[model samples]
Target: SPQDLTVSLIPVSGLKAGKNAPSAKIAKLVVNSTTLKEFGVRGISNNVVDSTGTAWRVAGKNTGKEIGVGLSSDSLRRSDSTEKWNGVNWMTFNSNDTLDIVLTGPAQNVTADTYPITLDVVGYQP
Candidate 1:
């Protein structure tokens, strides 16, 4: 049987537009299980779109106007495949472990607005 997991994000201060701003803490993932489990996360979409479905633009005057989104986590390691979760390099957490999710703004275009992004978490129990 598969164990149930509860994940949640703790909101932090607003993110400033540009790489000069420090990374903001986006989420605190909590895994509920008696045994250890390995997990990895990836963006569900390519670009971070706003509620109006517009790609996020870089912040700055006379910028290139490119689109970008950045997400990261210190607890989770990068995986070779987005759809597959191999126990080898994935993040392993014991029962009730909390993982912090961080996001760094792109160099140029970001605004003072909220952009909702979805992430898929792949977990494996071995």
Candidate 2:
């Protein structure tokens, strides 16, 4: 393409939350993309790390391959299951606790170049 267009699904293999993270789950999401339809989220899961640096991947609400852990997007909730969105929420942890996050989705206007996307996770404390 002369305009330089690259389409790809942004894969969030893992995201780790630190002990200072709030307990509340995902309260909101902010996405920046060139096309709405071109962007879609999926497979948002988490893993908590203990003081020993051990990680325990939380099971997904859905009982299927990779289904157990993922973003639990709105479409997935309405069409697939009735479970809450907690399936992709960031959980609280003890001292030195770290969260391992994994989020995968489609992206538009991708190009054959090095691009970096940063995910900033914030939640309410309760």
Candidate 3:
């Protein structure tokens, strides 16, 4: 039987608009007895919608205006292109490992508010 995997992220603070936010550490990834040979992680922007079902706009641009995600490890770093996942190489890991993830915002013209985001983890087996 394969064991379950656990992933967690540390709470981030002081994320300002219109700039590259501070990197957030994916504190832990407990890959137990799973048969997965490799794994990859990426982030996606969860744009908010209004009552009329219209996606929220940031200063005249889509919620994803200049939002981008970057994932980095001790050996490699990859960034998504403007809110889209371009697929990263599979990373082999042991029991516990950590990865640094960062989000970049528009260089200018942004408002102060919370922007929802999602992190997707994909695993592969041999």
Off by over 4 Å in 3: 21-38, 45-64, 73-95, 104-110, 123-126
Candidates by lDDT, descending order: 1, 3, 2
TM-score, one value per model? 0.51, 0.20, 0.46
Q: Residue 10: error of model 2 in Å?
A: 16
lDDT of 1: 0.45
Checking candidate 3 for backbone clashes, the offending pairs are none
**lDDT of model 1, residue 7:** 58
Query: Model 3, residue 110: displacement in angstroms?
Result: 5.3
Q: Which regions of candidate 2 are displaced past 4 Å?
A: 1-24, 44-69, 72-75, 78-126
For candidate 3, the per-residue lDDT at 50 reads 27
* Candidate numbers, best TM-score first, in rank order: 1, 3, 2
As a whole number from 0 to 100, the lDDT of residue 117 in candidate 3 is: 42
The whole-model lDDT of each prediction reads 0.45, 0.27, 0.39
Compose the digit string of candidate 3's lDDT tens values, residues 21-111.
3443312233333455444544433442222111122222444343333443342332121221243333344334455544323333345
Top TM-score model: 1
lDDT of 1 at 53: 18
Of 1 and 3, the candidate ranking higher by lDDT: 1
